[model samples]
Target chain A: MRYTSFTSYDLILLAQGLGVSVALFLVTTLIGFLIGTIWAVMRFYRVPLLTPLITFLAELLKNSPVLVQLFLVFFGLPALLKINVTPVEAAVITLSGNTAAFIYVIAVAAIESIGRDQIESARVFGLSRWQILRHVVAPQAMAFAIGPLTGLLVNQLQVTSLISVIGVVDLTKIGNILNLRTLKPFIVWTVVGGLYYIAAKLIALGGARLERRLRAHTAWKGL
Target chain B: MILAPHVPFLLKGALLTAEACALALFGSLVIGLLVAALRTSSSPLLSRAAFIYVDLFRNIPFIVQLFFFFYGLPEIGIYIDAFTTGVLALSIAGGAFSSDVIRSGILAIDTGILEAAEVSGLSKPTIFRKIVMPIALRTSIRPLGSVFINLVLTSSILSTITLNELTGSAKIVASDTFRPFEVYAVLLIVYASLTYLISLAIGALHRRLNRDRMPDVA
Candidate 1:
């Protein structure tokens, strides 16, 4: 007998899917953040050959669809390198690289948003380059960067859904499974879309909170 | 080297992609204009309804939205092909984004001009069409271009629903040639260059249309 009804166990299945999605998003984001920042710093220091190369790579990644990039890593890389890549591993690598490319663009912009006069004055204060960056640029740039970073994070969360196309059993994939099993696309997809919507809202909320905290130093306190 | 034989097949797919994006772009512009008008209208209820539409569509993933229409429409007995469904989904999603752009453009209009039009005794629709829209659209050409470019990139997702657009055709070639790397790598560069050319064209169009304005504005 084909049991096509929605069972209570499906709730647990959804929660597990959500957990997988959230975990992957957080891990990839952290990795992307570090790699992106390093690339930005290399540009800042004018590392001779790598800066232009990094810029081109970031531009290429940003311009292309994330789905294609996922395919490249998941299918293309394994076929080319003659190695097996599990779906989850492919999702992680692709998402992280894509995220890093975007973050690098934001970081470069945030760093450039700092005025040259401030840096020159800091130099005259006899502070070393690293010290100037640490004390002077970092705080201001963080405040500037948070707004765009928040937007990027929310977008990256949605981009994570594409990994489902490649067979990772994340929330979307779970939705796909339920969608087929129950043959109820409306109910199944609505529930799945609702989960993603809530997650995106939560990330936006967290980003706003962080932005406020970062800008606290600039907020006026009335006497 | 291996991709040369498949070039004609891939071009056919790219033609389909171009057709879908072109139709969707026109559809989106119309929807965007209407939504922007509604959002900017004096009626609070209409604006609120429009706002909810934009918010819901924007917050949800495009693929989710696509599937909602793709699958749900069939259930409701609408019975459209994947191509029609993909275009409809793309237009709706693109409308949400372009509406935001157009709404901002509308908001940026100078109050003096509206007041002058009011004093000239033009009807509301006439005033909006004659004065507001032209100015808003011209100023926002650059942003609208980016949104269209995004629509192009997002068109690749239509492959999932069995529509053999550019990305879909590339997938077939990949499996057939057993060279997923070359196929996808070339596909990626093709997409990047296509968008780059579009951006350049948009820049020229913006400059041409806005030439009468201040130099900085152009």
Candidate 2:
């Protein structure tokens, strides 16, 4: 028998694939956030060499396609450095780096969105630079950033699908497998695309909730 | 030296990429303009339908959409070549994004101008073509250019469909020369510079177009 029909186990496989995709999305997002914020902090302090270098790297990353970056890490790096890289490891590294580059851009923009007068005012109150950044800038910048950050996260989620191309066996990869097995591209892709669409919507909703909370203090009240 | 021997091959691929992007750009502009018009129209039904199209296309991954079209079209007996399919896919996706940009450009138009056009007894199509489109497109030149540049970068994905674009050719060279690093690195830089040049050109075009009316923006 050719065994081409869909099995009940395929649902479990899809669930597993969704788990991998979401887990990778969360982990890479956390890593990207930390690294990106650190880069922003470095720039805030005006670190001599690192600031400019980070900016350049971020620009290079922003301009190029994520697929190229994934290929570089997955295939190029292993060959060049003589190190072994599994597909998942490569996906994590590439996705996180790409996410960090974008986050760095957004964070920098958010930070710059803070008025210089606020910092000067804090300084006049005898606060140190770090203290001013934390006490004065952080809160407002967070509020400023959440909207764009949500947009970026939704984008990055879609980007995670590309990892399938490099053999990560992600949700899209699972979809590919089932698609090949059943030879039903329409059904397979529709279900897969639907899953992705729902995930994106959830992320957008969460971001909106967060943005509302962050901006609650400034929202207008009835007279 | 690593890239020298492969320059001609890469250039051939670039020509195809350029051709595909040009066609797709033209296609996208038409779709984008129509969608923008629909979205901005007085009819709620058309606007809602247009909104759903934009949202669905924008939310879905381009590769998935490409695969859907690539695979599903044949199932429906709508056979087409990969090149045409790729162009169509790009135009559809690009239309979604460019429509949003153009829609904003349309929204940004001064109400006074529209009122004046209305008083001058211009028909809806004539008003759109004469007053609204020129102004919207002119103001939105820069963003639309970014959309086109994105179209160029996104063209790399067409390689997956067996279209011999720049990225596809680079893949062949990479495997043949056994230099994945050099090949991809050079490829990355080439794409970046190409987009950079396009942005520069867009900036010049924007300045030139807006020179007469909006000197500050120019």
Candidate 3:
């Protein structure tokens, strides 16, 4: 007896798969956010030798393929360093670093968008560097950064799909399993791609909302 | 220690990676130029068709598209090797992106300049050839560099279809060498450094190309 029909359980599998992808995405994004902010600050302060080094590191991470980064972490690092790296761990590290690199660039640009006069004024007002960053730079920079940040997040969402290759059992991997079992690329891939598409759209929508809120202070109040 | 012996094999893989990226870059540029022209054309139908192609390719995951072509192609009469398939897929995807850059480049051309050429009695083909393309290309050289960098990064996905480019080669070395972490770390650094150098060169080129056109900010 051949069982070629689509099973009802595949829905559950897809949901579970998407859960893994989203969970990993959120976790890494948070980690990446923090690390990327730090990298940006490194540049902002002109930390002597460290600034160029961070810039170089970010460039390297930004330019190279995530797949190579994944392999390096997942397959290469374990063998060379003689340490165990879970697939999820590898995915998190690689994706976070990659995300951070892009964010670092955006943050630096956002910070720079705040003209020197504004920074100098803040400096004159007896604001500490930390206070200036928090009270002066961060607010304005966030507004400046949000537009490009939305684009980056959208691209990063697509990038999360690559983690499936490292055996993270993410949505893409689930689709692979279902596709082979059901032998229906049309049904399987369409469903998988639809889920991804919806998720991407949702992120974009959320980003738009966040950007609006961030930019609210800068909205014109009319003369 | 284990991977020390695989240097020769890895070098061979690097060569394959270079070859694939080189071919794919040329293929993408040709495809990009044609699509860019279509996008900017006066014909609404052609422009709409080009827009749909770009949107479809950009929205779909590369792996899904790759699998569709890899599995779906055999169902049809077409049969191509993995290397060829990889290059073809890269070209299509890269073209979609490259076209966007080129289209903007085309749009950025001065209407005044075009008018001058037209008033000179230059044909459409000659105007596009001698006047528009050179200027658009010179201004866009930097954006095009990023697209190519993304293409290089995307090439790693080609490995899943059984094409052992640089990342593919490193995969074998990792398992055989019994140092997955170290091997991958090194590979990551190598790729990063390679692209850094490429962008540095692009920056230099952009500065040179736009040196005389300072006010325009090419």
Winning model by DockQ: 1
Candidate 1 Cα errors over 4 Å, as ranges: none
* Clashes by residue pair, model 1: none
Let me know the DockQ for model 2. 0.75
Q: Write the per-residue lDDT of candidate 1 for residues A22-85, one digit (tens) a residue.
A: 9999999999999999999899889999999999999999999999999999999999999999
Task: Give each model's whole-structure lDDT.
Answer: 0.94, 0.92, 0.86
lDDT of 2 by residue, B155-215 (tens): 8889988998998898899888899998899888988889889999999999999998877
**Winner of 1 and 2 under lDDT:** 1
Ranked by TM-score from best down, the candidates are 1, 2, 3
Ranking by lDDT: 1, 2, 3
For candidate 1, the clash count comes to 0
TM-score, one value per model: 0.98, 0.97, 0.91
By TM-score, the best candidate is 1
Model 3, A99-193: lDDT tens digits are 99999999999999999999899899889888989989999999899889887887887788898888889988998888777777767777887
True contacts kept of 3: 0.60
**iRMSD of all candidate structures:** 0.7, 0.9, 2.0
Using lDDT, give the best candidate's number. 1
